[model samples]
Target: MRLILPILFLTILSIKAFSREVASDSLANIARNAMFTDAYIQIEGKLHSKKLKVEVNLGDTPEQTKAGKEYSEKLTGKSHMLLS
Candidate 1:
């Protein structure tokens, strides 16, 4: 029904907004705990380097999961990563 679709959409949007709020807060925590002081990334098949879709997660150094995200984002033109 029409009403069902609108209700579903609203619920999904609210859930997304809430999730983002939570994730950002976690980002602050991660940054504080991150192990890597700083990082740079490389892109595949690109002659010139560019920085995009960039965000640094918190840790003293970059952990595997966080670094993997940065690496995948850099390669978005050629590939993307997803968590399950």
Candidate 2:
């Protein structure tokens, strides 16, 4: 019974892990700019906390640059480089 329970639990975990979908190209691109990348974050440890880092070097795209300019001009009244 003990062995059965452990096997069942492992099977469940494996199934859940396998159920996750692979990221699409756009989603993978977005992940490069997500909070999980290139950000210094404080992580809590059992005894102490430390600043953790995840570096993400993003190659800029024209679409992202245009979006940023639009956002800044429309929302913040700031001039930004126009996306060509």
Each prediction's RMSD over C-alphas, in Å, is: 15.0, 16.2
- Best prediction by TM-score: 1
User: Per-residue alpha-carbon lDDT of model 2 for 1-84, expressed as tens digits?
Assistant: 889999999999999988977669878888777764232222222322232222222225666555555543443322332222
CA lDDT, candidate 1, residue 54: 40
Local distance difference test, per candidate? 0.57, 0.48
Tens-digit lDDT string for candidate 1 (1-84): 989999999999989888833578788999899854444443344344343344334334447557767666655654333222
Which ten contiguous residues of candidate 1 have the minimum total lDDT?
Answer: 49-58
TM-score of 2: 0.24
TM-score of each: 0.25, 0.24
Stretches > 4 Å off in candidate 2: 21-84
Model 2: colliding residue pairs: 38-54
